[model samples]
Target: MKDAHSNRVLLLSLLIGFIVVSLFVLGVRTLVPPDEGRYAEMAREMFASGDWITTRLNGIKYFEKPPLQTWMNALSFTLFGVGDWQARLWTGLCGIIGVLLTGYAGARVYGPRVGLYAALVLGSSFYWVACSQINSLDMGLSGMMTIALCALLVAQRDSATPTEQRNWMLLCWAGMALAVLSKGLIGLVLPGGVLVFYTLAARDWQIWTRLHLGKGLLLFFAIAAPWFVLVGLQNPEQPHFFFIHEHFDRFLLKEHKREAAWWIFLALLAAGCVPWLGVLVQSLLQSLRRTPGAAQERFRPGLLLLVWVVFIIAFFTKSSSKLPGYILPVFPAVALMIAHYLETASRRSRSVNAALLVLLGAAFLGFVPFMLRLAKRAGEDLLYQQYQPWVLAAGIVALAGGVLALVFDRRLQRDRAVIALALGGFFATHLILAGFEPIGQARAGVGMVPAIRAEIMPTSTIYAVGLYEQSLTFYLGRPVVLVDYLDEFSFGLQQQPALAIPTVDAFVVQWRAHAAAGVRDIAITRDDIVAQLKKDGVPVRIVAADARRIVIANF
Candidate 1:
């Protein structure tokens, strides 16, 4: 009882500290581009335009994704009045919700101890914590999928009454609906695929009857169908671009250019799991064995979880588009599996987990010297230099945490070992990510924002030439004209031909004309463009210049 009480106190303290740090970091970093800036700016545009159905990025019709994130962000802005923290609130909440839901579900399905461990494992994992604060659609998608996954677990647990199963299954459906809105069809498709694989592998066809498909499907369509319908009606072209182009092409073709080596996510899982990386394979292997429960209880949760992890990894691996976060949906499952393993984990297993963190920290310390070589562009060497100490500090923290955890594990104070490792892993990732502000701020064009904001008149025509600094428009609270730039916006620009300047010649004509009319023309363009404009006597007065870009004015 005394040990339990002490552990509870430590857990509560860690929970409080984690929440405080998590909330504080959401606002600390400048919204990084292109993902952070792009999504936040989309929300800002939605909030400003009051058109929730048709999403736009930089004043172009953006149908690349659904509007769930945009709606949530726009609503956040409405309530909180448009700041970086407010923009991140939705994804942040999603992250928190996922943790709580996973914890609750694990407790209900497994045991209270396992539930607690699951939450601790997930909340501290580098990937989960990092994505939680980031203003990305991945977190939103992962969050909703978490709800779906956990609901299914609770609904299927052996102790659940028929009523409990039905209601939770309904929630499971609603979560899929929200997931669809959050990302796209994958919300439903991925879960549905997992169910199919689970049934075949476990040979539990009876699981089908318990899913409450009729009412669940009705509820799902009711929630998910409206947005796709409204958006399609508002812009008939959205369906083709979204359903066919975005989904099919992105998966089947290498045109998205996100393709990585097939082993990429395998590597990410190893790193992203952090301290748990040592136990990952063993936990998954443990799932391959039958877990103790009623012989009549045909719902094999371990099999289901194993299938979830394998299927998601396999599904994304087969796709030509591979990104780090594609496997994010598996973290919750992995955490649950790890927690179950830790319930009976030997001292050796615990020692290895602690040791991995130490090695990771040492690796970070080792890599500190190579940061200078990581700079792709000029002036970034300084940013890398600035980032080294943060990495060093993170390494030290992880090393210390691992050493402490090893000591506790050796002493057989299992709970303390886990808690110590959790704290260490959590802080190590947070420090490294937070320390990235210098580099993120530089990439985000935040330094230029104040200077750029001061020079802009109400009628100033802002044009992004050759490149779009995604976060720049978000910081300024306005969209810019696109000049000779149509990378992701090509489909949107094809539909709205008038939203962009089309070519440099056309932009130059407009800039020269605006100058004559006493209008301020601000063009944030490449250094080469600024140089050429000056060399060609094109009337560009440089306002601010950076190694990568130059903010100029027509005067």
Candidate 2:
């Protein structure tokens, strides 16, 4: 009875700690550009327009991805009034769900201690923590995919009753459906491909019969098919662009323009698993010793996990378009595998973890001066200098935790040692991410918003020329008319020719007409364009200027 009470206390403490930490950090930093701002604006617009079926960006028809994330973001905006932290609620919640689900799955598969450790490992991993706090589609997709994968593993366990197995299978299908809604077809493709590979590799053809296919398919289509069908019917062009351009062409061609050498993902994995590298390497080696054989014939979850990791890496490696977060779906599996290994390992593994933590701490502390030089070289010395204290604090905390873990290991308190190291990792990673506030402030255009907002009323015509600040639309509380610029939104403009000015000369003509008509109009462009516009004899008043951009209004 006492042991159970202690276990409950531990679980409650961890849950509360995770929620508090996640909430505190959610609103502390500005949203980063490109992914964060773009997705958030999409959601903001969704809320503004109240059109949930068709996803639009800056009031232009955007069919690149599905609207699952946008829907949630819109819902969050409706409930929480559309601030930075509110915009990020879906992602943070998904991440939390992912961690808890991983722990639960781990507990069921390995044991309670292993489950808790797996959750801790995932929560502390650099990529996972950073992605969870930002407004990004990857976290939502990764979290849903993790749920789908973990559900499959739990359902396939031997101890489940026939009825329980059916229910678990339904959960798996629902997870995949939500995942598909989160990103696109890749969610389904990745998991289905991994399953096929596992089936063939393990020579487990009979396992197919165990899946409740009929009911599962009905459930999947019920959740995932409605949006695709509804959206496609409303926008005829969506079917072609989404399936072909977004999926096939994105993978087969270099059209998305995110091409990178194969080795980039390798670097990302190493950096993402920092402080756990040594333990993970040893765990993987230990995992390899238990191959699928007759001795352990009920099921080989480890082999399944290995196949999951290998297939995802290989699949994305072959794709022409790649990003660092594309491989996140594999992380939960990696955590589970590591936790499983840790559960059965000797005391030497704890020593290795402590050593890795010490190495990480020493590296951070020892290279402080060098990091400052690099920061200076990158022309971000001020931001880096301000960030230095947090970096040092993270290092000191990590070193302290490592030393504490070592002491606990000596006292034969394995769980305490593991928890100490896990807490160290969590704090260190969050500190580094929080230190990015200065960088985000400078680059994300949050500072420029208030000045620009004061100069232009809600009724004023605003044009973003030559460049797009991804966060500008959200901050301004409305869309900016794009002038002579179309990158990713080219398809939208092509479909609706009236939404943008096609050339600078065209914009000049419009500007003169608006000025003549006594209309208040603002244009945001690069500083060079402002100079050229003045030289070309256009009447303009500079409203605000940042280092990289200038906002001009017709005089």
Candidate 3:
């Protein structure tokens, strides 16, 4: 019966993990608010044009990012159809794998309870939840990093056994190779930081011999170097800007011109871990208070987790450019640390449950005013009308969950119940937030692109004046010629008969000259010489008009 009960608990934990992870995977969608659409469209354009070497947005050379992510999306499109969901599926699946691997690592180091909690925390994290649902490189990069970290831990744990150590070390190198493919040098940088720090602190120089550094280096180069060499050979001009400027200069100096103070990232990390912030803080404090012996035994894992989090924060803080998803690879370690805390607390104190309940209650209350503001901003009066009932429902769930946790604090079964309740509150709050207003706002601007495309001729030269919408370019499936009011925005504009005018007067002069030279059936913004032409008896047809500008095709 004891064995049977143990098996049942394991099955139940696995089942819960599956359900939670599935909720995260299935609930999130492709073409999320910002970067996903841009990346997906770039890949679509690349696949459509059959250009594997250089990434082109609307048929012009775009070298802002490497082609690896675009290549992944293109492959997905080839296997599946070229749609939002198919493009985002790669990231979503990677996120799921990351959650599982995190759980596996936790189970090995701590126990099944820790494993389950780690997966739960990660699956529910706002950052992971948001990033996984999009078509971006971060999810894949995070997965690769998590795999590498887990392999390193396994190798460290098995250092006394040479054969097991060798196997684990091989996995670590393999993971590092994949991580490089996912992002860049930071793959090696982050893991390398953790390993070095661990070795120095624990005074474990013997472990270095077990790592087989020569073999590992050769393997890493063998897997990750060829692609860089091939892609570089394919595009000779890529080296100076891509390698030195983008990778190094961006990090070391503020060349990209995106410097932020260190504390800003600390605030971002706190925000990214939302709802779990209180528990994570407690965990960090607890880890800090450990003695040297305890530190040596568990210090490597904790230090590794800390290093992963700190290095990313420091790296990005010092970088000339920054984005929210850049810090995502650190989330796995954060989740692991939080999971360990929760498991330890559950074993030792009932006060932990009390604290979690309080956090959930606060989170529930916090959403009410936030949702109202979001609804007002999005102009969704109907959501405001329906808001009270949803708020009440969420509050009820939170209260019920809190009461249940308080009532059954001593029961092991109640632990899962409390988790379910917390999950319910989180899901309910986000479901309302996601479904009601924010999504509508994100789609509002691009919603008219399809209509504009339909109104214009298939081969009609469309141009964006002083505006760039990558999503628009991707959906239009044709290069929207950019009339450059600026030179910086010229990279993504297609090669066509267009003038990159620096000023409105220059554009007006050029348009008149082109028209006089018998360039008939030209498309121009209504303000860009079309108005003057209309005054001069030049026939103009309004192709499409939006809140911002008008598209006029004239003869």
Best by lDDT: 1
Q: Return the top candidate by TM-score.
A: 1
Residue pairs with clashing backbones, model 3: none
List the global CA lDDT of all models: 0.90, 0.84, 0.64
Per-model TM values vs. the true structure: 0.97, 0.96, 0.82
lDDT of 3 at 508: 50
Candidate 3 — which residues are off by over 4 angstroms? 1-34, 159-161, 288-299, 346-414, 425-433, 436-444, 485-555
For all predictions, the C-alpha RMSD in Å is 1.5, 2.1, 4.6
The digit string of per-residue lDDT tens for model 2 on 1-555 reads: 233214788879888998899877888888788888899899999999889999999999999888989999899999989888888889999888898898888888777877888888888777788789989899999999988888888888767778878998899999999999999998899989988988887777876877899999999999999999998899999999899888989899986788999988767776776556657766656554553343656656677887888888899999999998898888888888878776666787778878889888988898776666755324578778788888888898788878888888888777777778878888988888888798777777777888777777656799999988887667778888898788999999989979988888899998999889888789989988888999999989988776667889996
- For model 2, what is the error of residue 224's alpha carbon versus the real structure, in angstroms, after optimal superposition? 0.5
Instruction: Give the clashing residue pairs of candidate 2, or none.
Output: none
lDDT for predicted candidate 1 compared with the true structure = 0.90
Ranking by lDDT: 1, 2, 3
Ranking by TM-score: 1, 2, 3
Error of 1 at 68 (Å): 0.9
Two-way TM-score contest, 1 vs 3, winner: 1
